[model samples]
Target: MATVKFNPKDILYHYCSTEAFHSIVTTHSIRLSSMSLSNDSMEGKMVEEALARLAECDKCDQGTISLLQAQFEVYLKDVDGFGFCLSKKRELLSQWRAYASDATGVAIGFSRDYLELLREEYLRQRDPFLGFTIAEVMYDPEDHEKQVRPLYQQIKHAIDEGDLLEAKKHSPLRSWSNDTETQRKKSCLASLGFSTLMATLAFAFVLKSEAFKEEDELRLLALINRGEIKKLGFDVKSNSLRPYREYELKKFDQCTPVIKEVILGPKHRSPISVVEDFLRCNGFGYVHVSRSAVPYQ
Candidate 1:
């Protein structure tokens, strides 16, 4: 892997001097590569996976960003004393400035210039309030905007287009390799998230069905009343039982029973348990003994 000359602190400062920046960076931290990427082969897959996660994160962070922005606006109003408030604000500003510097340094792995460019572009679009210190605003979510998604999509597109080597030209994280256990896990998780999202979307479209006849509608109504359709929503109580008819037509009805058996069965063969067992058996670490067993397997 290529050596990173930049510092994490500097990268942090360049991108995360504000609350919005901090939130965005931390979120990416959790959803993206938790460890540095190291393997060339896994880089493309990891990048694509990271992009999908970022999209989901963007959707979830919108509400948080708005709330943070509102707090920044109302902060002064809530302060009891001017001197105390100013002191607190100053302290926060200093902390954020330092934090931003540190994070920027860390992000130097992504290519210092690229990180800076992205940061500048994001800030240019956001134009956050300049009065408060960077530290004070690092957690506020309201300042986030559309740039996050577009940037993420750009990366994703690059990966899908078979530009793996070129895409990492600016990426800070190393690609995953078998030698680096951390990178492998991070890459695997990203792949899983990408696959899951794709499955959900495809399921929504491919499995779409409609209820056209009266008999079908009555059958749906009966299923809904019987609690076969868990939630009492539009899908269940539609006039023509369109939702029910559609759902039954989909593979979910056939697959759901099996899925539930795997998920809710006493054998404990659910995805979570499977993952836990795999990790434990593979020597990642041992988990506490549980009564759970996978009888199906």
Candidate 2:
């Protein structure tokens, strides 16, 4: 095999949040623990076979692994923040468990049909907020606008009717919230306020149909094709991007175009410069980029 060289600075990293970084790390830690435990349970060939099977099951496609390694290299360049929200951690843990279960099932010679079933279950249980975030960054703004229009209308109608339950049902925090009626009402109102503000901003900046020139669209498509921009859990079909899998985005389904956050990475520019460039070039002011806190190993 030929030796390959890697230069960290040439990679672009993308992450949903600090919580997501922690989750990925935590899952790897647990897998390491399992490998160690297997050593004590079996000897020699048995242990080697077990380890090989585990490694095989844990393997991601080369393209994905390369992408992840590049992201981690960028992350290691700067590290900050130790704490993660409890809810986010739990949500990540659930996803980790599902992934582990599916991999293990396949390694143990489970039926291919069973593996497919597990895959479907895993998709159903993933974090919708993260999914939306990925979709927003990876997809064309026009494609995102189509996905969120119906959900936006629903949220507006629910708020206008003063139906807290209905409004909460359309919130991104729907699964995360377990508040009393008063608290739920307060949460609904807060979300409404934020949405209204975002709507105004979107109209002024993002929703102007003419804001994106033909050349700008071509530029974005080129970036995506060159892998400078990565879109997770979505695919381009018929010259438009759409979610490639099912996820929980019902609450923010309509507002995703207006509210989803975009991430800019140092691979494309120095940290200080990327933000300014993204805002100016993308024509949307809601882009987010990490400056100091890197939470991944």
Candidate 3:
């Protein structure tokens, strides 16, 4: 076979986010610093002892630490200016590929199992008298609590009158609410027209529940007011909903180019192309592949 040459600088790569890229570099730098400190004559034993203690505190097994150390060495050798060389990039891509494959199966299985459990829970909590399902009550745009209050009042009246059997017979589970048809129709229309909007609102509710700092929430709110969130494809309707972490919001301001270079390996496709293909195959449509003009210094 003829001799082959490779140039590390010629390989093109991009990170999912600058923070992710920075984290990789910073972690490697920290490890390199630790290795240096532990190798020095005066601090060698002390540094090693400290590291061992810290590892023990973290509950890291020896095998895991050894594997991580080996990986870090490879990372230090192959990572370069805002990207990895071809070999390292390929290695990372392989890992991501494996994860992507496994994640698809796991996600499907989890969703199916969780949905069944949710349906069962809904049925169990449903009012026996109420003709409509609990899902309808939860998702109905109208004042559901107000609608259910009268039924509870009737049940209370029956119980107070010492007619326990009557109360049970007229229980929300046993009785059909008078407005079930109207409510059902409204729910159907809402599901048809505003399903995505409702889901987005629910996601915002979950994020707000995390109780992020007021300042962070205010910053995210400002971005919402400026229509930046809309630009990012989130249809956020309220300033109260802070749907992203501080670092995630910071990534929106980033304009780093996602380097796209031809791959020379067995799969002759660029890493970016491979990612695009994976996304498309998994039903992610038309991902934006952006490039920035800033030179890698």
Candidate 4:
């Protein structure tokens, strides 16, 4: 989890079925769905377990680790998250099979600058605690510790100085009741600074199972309290209603397209001109479209 630098010019690819692609172009939006309802049962919690194991390996103080662990549990109980996924690799085989429709799916390449800027601007007018981030997914469990160490140290240092309670007292969480704050002095709402908690949550959502490494994903993630439900929608998947939010990154006749390129899947039947025409009609004529080079059926 060393600092991975990505240029603003980097391209992140979103893969989807032809029907999903049509809906994307028609609606000019991407969906950020809830992680709680994800296909992978061990979504955010896998990283939590990894972080705990790493903490023990570092031989952190039993009291401090236990306290922080308890706080993490309580703090996360009320937390919910949403994510929009993209990949560092374009036209990837596994990505095609898992996310995109076999051969009929397509990949849209977006400007990293455009996507990040959109989130920043959108958050300016929203709550700061939304904890929104565009991040690379970490597959190695051993690397999970790097993402949480600084925050862990911050709490540990406060405990060593016997000022953990003092610091917690000063950092009053508006959501916490007076009695609750007093009882849970070392909890995230008390001892952990907002930045520390926000950073931890961001990494938690991105540190997924290594089994999914082939996806080479870069996710646009948001960790929010279940209270601030705004513009959220639900779709029926697997006979259950899953929550999602539409992120509007493009619009017809908008200033410019955030999409830089579109790669048609290997089995795409439409001619190049027809695809280009579709872009032109939708005000994204500038986006370059090419068929994927994969030799897949």
- lDDT of every model, 2 decimals: 0.26, 0.27, 0.26, 0.73
- 10 residues in a row with least lDDT, candidate 3: 103-112
Model 4 segments more than 4 A misplaced: 1-9, 58-71, 126-131, 151-194, 250-256
Q: Please, what are the lDDT tens digits per residue for candidate 1 over residues 153-216?
A: 5334434443433323323365444456445434533443454333222111111112211111
TM-score of candidate 4 to 2 decimals:
0.75
Please provide the root mean square deviation of candidate 2 (C-alpha atoms, Å).
26.1
lDDT of 4 by residue, 117-228 (tens): 7776667755554435788899887677777777667656656655554444454454444666445553643545777776776677788887899888988888767765
Order of quality (TM-score): 4, 2, 1, 3
Candidates sorted by lDDT, descending order? 4, 2, 3, 1
Clashes of each: 38, 3, 7, 0
lDDT of 3 by residue, 156-193 (tens): 33334434333233433464345765445334422332
Off by over 4 Å in 1: 1-53, 57-138, 141-145, 165-297
> TM-score: which candidate is best?
4
Q: State how far residue 246 of model 2 sits from its true place (Å).
A: 30
Candidate 4 minimal-lDDT segment of 10 residues? 1-10
TM-score of 1: 0.16
Clashing pairs in 3: 127-173, 128-173, 128-174, 129-172, 129-173, 129-174, 129-175
